[model samples]
Target: MSARPRSKTRATWLTLLGGTFGLHRFWRHGLRDAWGWLHLLATLTGLAGLQRLDAFGIDDAQAAWMLPLGGLSFAAAMLATILTGLTPDERWDAQHNAGRSGGTPPSGWGAVLAVIAALLIGTTVLMSSIAFGLQRWFEAQAEADLQTPQRISVPR
Candidate 1:
């Protein structure tokens, strides 16, 4: 089978580099497949929760950096996919070619997954500690309140 000619209009290059900034969707296609568009919607919901949990210092009405991070990850994944399709040399020729690892990009998913797991475990432990402290504080306050009970109207 004949090979498709290399695109010279910079779509490939833009898609590869724009991945870092998450501009690939707009470069490859039109405005319809915008990367940050749908990403922002989902991030908004997460941002609400983020605020509730005080994850980030962002205001309740404002957007969070999570939206941009999501888009960037999308771009990274798609560009890596495209790179895996081409030969090592061909991929190197493409713009922003992250050195081909045996003709394939490293599976960054594992790293992301591991980091997520670590963060979850860490947060759980921290919350547990904080809850324990709060529980003790509440018990002490209740004891004090009982010891200093206000005199009520006994029998008229």
Candidate 2:
């Protein structure tokens, strides 16, 4: 049996809203796919770890592991949404709409939405990452400065 045609617009929305949980993947590949489940698990675990760290005020070292998982998940979701929306209708139809009797699926501003989302989300994520790195670097530098002794010279 041939797969039914899926809407790129709807798929883009699902990826935007629940890509970390692999909702888009489930929509495309069904619930039995291990990749979808893996995405879900990783995102959930990362979020849980972050919550725990925040609640307990854990050390930065402890929080380090969680950030990668969360950041990776966020990047993947945004990128997937962008890619899905930007994909040409013909290619999308060939990959996902083939064999379906349904006429042309309406794309409905998919490219526009994708471009907007990519610019907004991508910029925010990139900025936040840079800020986080800067904060960590400053903190480390402050620690080092505090540890170093200041030199004093006696004047006649």
Best by TM-score: 2
TM-score of each: 0.29, 0.75
Please give the CA lDDT of all the candidate structures: 0.43, 0.76
Q: What are the per-residue Cα lDDT tens digits for candidate 2 across 37-138?
A: 988987886787678678766456545456556666776778888888888888888888878867666687865676587668866765664565566567
The lDDT leader among the candidates is 2
Superposition TM-score, candidate 1 onto the true structure: 0.29
User: Candidate 1's error at 138, in angstroms?
Assistant: 0.8
True lDDT of residue 104, candidate 1: 28
Error of 2 at 27 (Å): 0.8
Clash number for each model: 0, 0
